[model samples]
Target chain A: MKPARAAWLFLAPALLVLGVFFLLPVLGALGLSFTDYDLYALADLHRLRFVALGNYWALLHRPAFWAALGHTFYFVAVGVPLSLAASLGAALLLASPLARCRAFFRTALFAPVVTTAVAMAVVWRYLFNTQYGWANHVLGAIGIHPVDWLGDPHWAMPTIILFAVWKNFGYNMIILLAGLQAIPRELYEAARLDGASAWRQFRHISLPLLGPTLLMVTILTVSGYFQLFAEPYVMTEGGPLESTTSVLYLMYEDGFKWWNLGTAAAEAFLLFLVMFAATLALLRWPRRSGA
Target chain B: MMPRLARALVNGLLLGGALVALFPLAWMLAVSCMPPGTANTLPPPLWPAHPTLDNYRQLFAHAGMWRYLGNSFLISGAITLLSLTCNLLAGYAFAKLRFAGRERLFRSLLGLLVVPAQVAMLPLFLLFKYTGLVDSYAGVVLPGAATVLGIFLVRQYAQGLPDALLEAARIDGASELRIFTTIVLPLLRPVIATLAILTFLAAWNDFMWPLIELTGQDHYTLPLGLAAMAREHTAGTESLMAGSVLTVLPVLLLFLSMQKYYLEGLLLGGVKG
Candidate 1:
């Protein structure tokens, strides 16, 4: 057989799966977004009516949709920076020559990333419990009030953000550690010869060199943080006056729970556009600054 | 003297961070073993004074956790094996084969990466429902069988294989299948290990898709089952902790045993892709 034919044969199963399951559904979702598809329509095809852009328009007027978007943006805005900082701090510590038990620390830091999120979120619910949680216990020890971490609307998103950071920072830490290791030791030595303090060396040499990795990690984290669902689903169930309801959680509820497939598909698309713009803006910022 | 002080500060910070990171998991285990209701006491105990297996026994016996555990194992295990095979073949072909539209197709796959998986989910569910796959193992397994990231990782690793190896095999009149199975596969073992671990951990820990797809109680994976249990058993702290342990322990142990491959795959997918 010809090599091309053989290649097609090799690609057949994977391509089939991707086309049928992933690619087709994506196009189908786009098409579905233009119509009024719901549980009734699902049961009877004739009930489906083409409402070109109606779902998107309805979402624009819906308060819950806007609130969900705001919550999702809050998560991304707050969670991304906290996650990156924690990751970078841990990575810096692990990378330091002064640090001992490097492997142990690295493994311990990364352990949370591999655990089941739903299960860990359950653990966090208990940890942040108002009356009986360790969080309140620690706060009381510090002469602080025992705040309702997951129950109060004002604090629920922040609590979830804290959980998100703890659960995810290790992933970026490993990547950034790899980036840190790749920088030449000579650069740091040269800076020291110039009497540069450690802070100056990091600012001038380390940060500049780690720019691309930092930006890439930022983009990945931003996008990942935007899809905040399982955390809120398991921890708060979008509770405390819906303070923790993320955009994806909203989409889940609208599409699955309420059987509003068209509206959910529209929400998904609107989110895609937002993510695309955010990533594009992120990519362009570094270039615009002549980095 | 300054260096010594700095070293002390750095080590102290590292120790503190490790404690923060590992504390929740450790607490989960401690609370799981505690006699029921003991964890709700004042000054939450770090260790169970009177440890027992009652929670675990109750979890398996009363809560139907054993069935969910079985479901999780079956779903994650099947997804791992099937996805590994799909990714390996496609990755190798993209890396080595002389094919029409190869680069274009690969670029298209990369483009698909930016569209979040959630977008496809709504219609995907409808499609599955139409096909009678909803609330079934196939519904969960099929969508996750081959991911763009998995294929990208394999292709990156496969690109490093020398052309001379494939050329020599071809010169010997080895069929493409023969060459792939005999020559390419053995060389791809490192990546295969990496992909297997990554895929298994992902499938085992996955909650969103399973939650949406598996509608029936009888078909729920561990995460789905545990989430449902949390809703109903909100006050059952010991039992919930035990259930969390059961849900997280398998993947945690798998990751610990294979940290090398898992980390390598993380860097490979993130840095390269």
Candidate 2:
């Protein structure tokens, strides 16, 4: 056989799988969004109505959708900064001149990143138990009252956020460490010669130098944070009266639990649009402001 | 000037941070061995006073953990093997084959990377639902069989192989499949190992898809099993910890053994860059 014919044969199986399974469903989702497909529509196609923009409109005006969106935004607003600060702090400490057992500490901090989220969340659920939880035990040591973490609506989302920060910050910590290492030692030396204090030197030499790395980390974190599902699902089940219901969590419940396929597809697309816009804004803001 | 006592305090703070980070996992193991009500005591013992394997025995006996363990192994192992075969072949073809539309197709696949896997997940569920593949292994397995990133990783690795060797094989009337299996397969061992470990871990830890697809408890994987077990109101702390231990141990060991490949794949995935 000619190599051209042979090559197509080689590519056929994978390409077919990707085209049918991946590309088709993505387009199917776009098509499904235009219809009024729901649990009834699942049983029969005749029940499905072609309702363009109706789902989007309902999502905008509906209190539940707005509440889910608000919950997602609340998560992003609180979770991202805490994660970034923890990562940057770990990276800074690891990059310190007097730091010893550098490799060991690096490994220790990153141990959580490789953990299966499902398993860790299981572990965390126990750790946040209202009565026997170690978190409360530690609080007890400090003479503080035990807080119902995953149980109370007010505390549930924040608890998930804490678990997320612990799970993820290490991954970015490594990236930021690499970013720190790439900065020339001479810049620190130069700053020292000018008698710059530690904080000022960090502001001038470290932050300025890490602009690109910081941007990438923030974008990746924001995207990851916005897709929050597994954390809330196994942790709180969008719980304490849906206070922890993220957009993806809402999408999951609407799509799978309720079988509202059309609305769920809209949720998925809206999430995609939001994330896409967030990334673009992140990339644009730094450049426009000349950060 | 800072005194020696001040320096000691800083080190103490760092040590405390490390301990706090690790204590949950450490305590999980400790509580798993404790007797039924031991961990729930007022003062909360640091070590189990009456350490026993009774909770583990109970988890395996009543909760059917072994079934979930088997489900996890079967799904993850199958995904790893399938991903290796499909990705390797497609990657090699993209790297070495002379075909029309190859670059365009591959480029488009790369474009799909920006769209999070979650975007397709919602629709994919409906697609599976219509096929009656929902609540089946096929449902859990089909969508992930050939990933764009997996193909891209293999292609990038395969691009560097010398053409002269393949040319000689072709001249000898060696079929492309023969060249792939007999020659390229052995050369691509390192990446295959890397991707296999990575894929297996990913499949094993996979939450959203398997949880969505496997509606019945009989088909639940370890993660799913553990999640359900954690929510059982009557479940003792010991049994839950045992479940956590069972779920986490495999991936933890895999990661520790092959940190290099995991990190390499991480950097390649654009998450690190």
The best candidate by DockQ is 1
Q: For candidate 2, list the clashing residue pairs, or say none.
A: none
User: What tens digits encode model 1's per-residue C-alpha lDDT throughout B1-273?
Assistant: 399999999999999999999999999999999998899999888899999999999989888898999999999999999999899999999999988799999999989889999999999999888889999999999998888888899899999999999999899999999999999999999999999999999999988888889999899999998999887755489889999999999999999999999999999998853
For TM-score, the strongest prediction is 1
What's the lDDT for all of these models?
A: 0.93, 0.85
lDDT digits (tens) for residues A81-198 of candidate 2: 9999999988888887756677777777877887789878878887888987778988998999999998899999999999999988888888888889989999999988998987
In model 2, what is the error at residue A254, expressed in angstroms?
A: 1.8
Q: What are the candidates' interface root-mean-square deviations?
A: 0.8, 2.5
Per-candidate RMSD, Å: 0.9, 2.5
lDDT (Cα, 0-100) at B91 in candidate 1: 92
**How does model 1 score on DockQ?**
0.87
Question: For model 2, how big is the iRMS in angstroms?
Answer: 2.5
- Report the lDDT of model 1 for residue B195: 95
